[model samples]
Target: MEGSCKMKRRLLMFTLVICSFFIAGVVSADEDILLQQLIEETPTGGILELEDKTYTGNIAISKPITIIGKEGTSIEGGGTGNVIEIRSDGVTLDTLAISGSGMSRSSQEEHSGVRVMANDAILTNLTITNSFHGIFLNKSKNTRMSNITVVGHGANQLGTQGNGIHIMRSSENYIDNSYLEKTRDGIYVEYSHNNFIDNNTMTDTRYGLHYMYSNYNSFKENNFIKNVGGAAIMHSDHIHLEDNKFSFNQGSRSFGLLIQTSRDIHVLNNEFHLNQRGLYLEQSTSNRIEGNDFFQNEIGIELWTSSTSHVFIKNHFNKNKVHALTVGGESNNDWFENGVGNYWNMPLLDLNQDGIGDDPLEYSSSLSELVEENELAYLFLASPAITIYEKANDLLTQHKVMAFDKYPIMSERKPINVASVGVGIILAGVGVYVYRRRALR
Candidate 1:
């Protein structure tokens, strides 16, 4: 019996020793340390904690680590330096406020707040302000950025150069829910392909979103407001723009949306207001434009030379000062909604009272075309020469005068409010009962 008890005691001691070793291993494995030491001691897939403090020096991350910043943490680069440089793949930066990065403009790509040259990296919920080239991604594929806000104050204290978010030679990336303001260009995608930019807000920038040689990219649900040159696309193909709002982009040469030297693009369900030109299509062909709203613009839609075979359907052109449709070149093959045209907001007398105008709406005429080219020609709109020009066009080319449904529905189709209707019916029944009772009394 004593020998059995001794054996049991030995087994318990061995188990306790093994457990102590396991506990020691776990405690060592889950140790949290400083940023530099954590980077050094951490394995490939470890977490690096950046505490809520101002980090001044530049830090180069060479390994695949997740740099998690504490909430309300600010990482301020003094000047002419990058706060976080990601050189390895699988890097993620979240909830960091990076600011004060601007340097001398030696090269076109000189200063940046965060320079990421790694693949499969993500930057989210980061605010970078007063910096040149905030969040520059070069040759990085499959990089995703969301909820990033970049503000370039263009303060006199620092040299002003570069863009807010510049993606060069990067492909298969996504940028969404971002806000950019007061930068050279809010989001510039150059030489990239197959990217997606959606749900972003860009204002007070030179150009809200500029895409050059970037093909097959989709932009949707973005708001470009008060930009100098809003949303220019050049030398790209198969681009799709949908449900974007371009408003208050007022400049002499600026446009709400510009498509140049592109082909096979589709623009649909967009709204443009108070811009110099609502939609400008130049040096492009075989594009589809449908269900767009152009209101209160100087020139609603302009198709300059080299634009051809574009389709326009179900578009609303209302309250435009000059021309609803300004067509140049010999481009035909454009389609309207069921042979019905856009709303011109002009007086077309219903002489026959058949719910259609007796005379067709003149979308393109000599006077309207001249007013589109020269903004000063709008002064002569009330002159007798304008009427003479319209009359001549109506007599010669009656095809220019297109007719749309006079009282077209302007509201979107929404679901019925059943609860409200039920309540209204109940209230009406109660009122009728009270009225009958009062009458009987």
Candidate 2:
């Protein structure tokens, strides 16, 4: 009886294992059938709508087709190549979650969530994560990438990780309304030109917008926060960076904007706040920096000796620990362009009330001359002792002027505080009620 019972138990265990394998094979068959339907069935230039289900493998769209996924539709990669690769022109991928790209940077093709080698590709409402590159436009032109959220593989080292949006040798692309974080660089433009990047939020990256040898690019209304460097416009020219917020990019060698070895750049109407350096210019010339507001920065502007022929006008420098720092030479740059100078938050001598100061506003101090030579001076920027020492030295010695505004602005052209006005109105109403009560009594 004991031998018979042991034999029955072995047969039962064998049957359970066979049942589990059969179920797994059925599921695998279903996944393979769906993948075959996607690859071998879709016609060229057709609109294929995926259901709200998960599909797997590396899809290569080699024809002009449009793939629109339903809500909650996801395409997981096979962990070998790019999740999706568009090879033909006029392809579109919308509303899909693409992830699990291969980690092989040594491959000829970059491993990415989506790789577009075709022109006029449109990618919208994509959630790309856990990929080497979120979206890589490789020599693709006239592409429109909008409303996408790209998160990188944050666990990888900086040298091995890729950028959120990497535009390489591409032109005339429109990238808008994207959120990029934890990437090596938020949006990297390398040898790309005539690109319009607007309404994007980039944070927790090396640089928000890393421009390298790119020209005729415009970045407008973007928010670059909590990054190592906000935007590094290096070895490039003809860039228009306007209406962006560069804030809280605090660290050593960090700045809201770094225009290095570039030319013909126009930086206008941007807000640079709470940065280690609001703007850092090095070896750049023939740039127009105008109508910008720099507030609460460690140093508002750090103009290197090699940076020349820059015109700074209508900029407001407010509450910075150091207004401007010139290293190694006199400031040959123009502080006032076309009769309007920057406002340094100082008392201006507006004798004729022409809204300009009569005397030139000088940024100078004997102690500043000494402290500017030391890199450790940044640590004591908020120290009262440093401020007192600078003022005392200025009063006792003939201070050397670092930079001067010939026509310092006198009128305040700041934004109106609606919250402050509301508080004042409430206070006045309470006071009037108290007075009426006293009179009645």
Top-scoring candidate (lDDT): 2
lDDT of candidate model 2 versus the reference? 0.85
Off by over 4 Å in 1: 1-38, 154-159, 325-340, 346-361, 365-441
Report the lDDT tens digits of candidate 1 across residue range 74-103. 777768676668899998888889887756
Model 1 TM-score, 2 decimals: 0.76
Q: For model 2, how does the per-residue alpha-carbon lDDT over 1-441 read when each residue is reduced to its tens digit? A: 999999999999999999975543221222435653564455666667777788886888887877888789899997879898889999988999999898778998778999999999999999998888999999989999999999875524667778999999999999999999989999999999999999999998999999999999999999999898999999999999899999999876678999999999999999999998899999999999998999998788888879999999889989887778787667689998666688889986776656778898988754445555777776666578777877787788766676788878875673234466779999999999999999999
Strongest candidate by TM-score: 2
Which residue pairs clash in candidate 1?
none
How far off is residue 401 in model 1, in Å? 6.8
Per candidate, the number of residue pairs that clash is: 0, 0
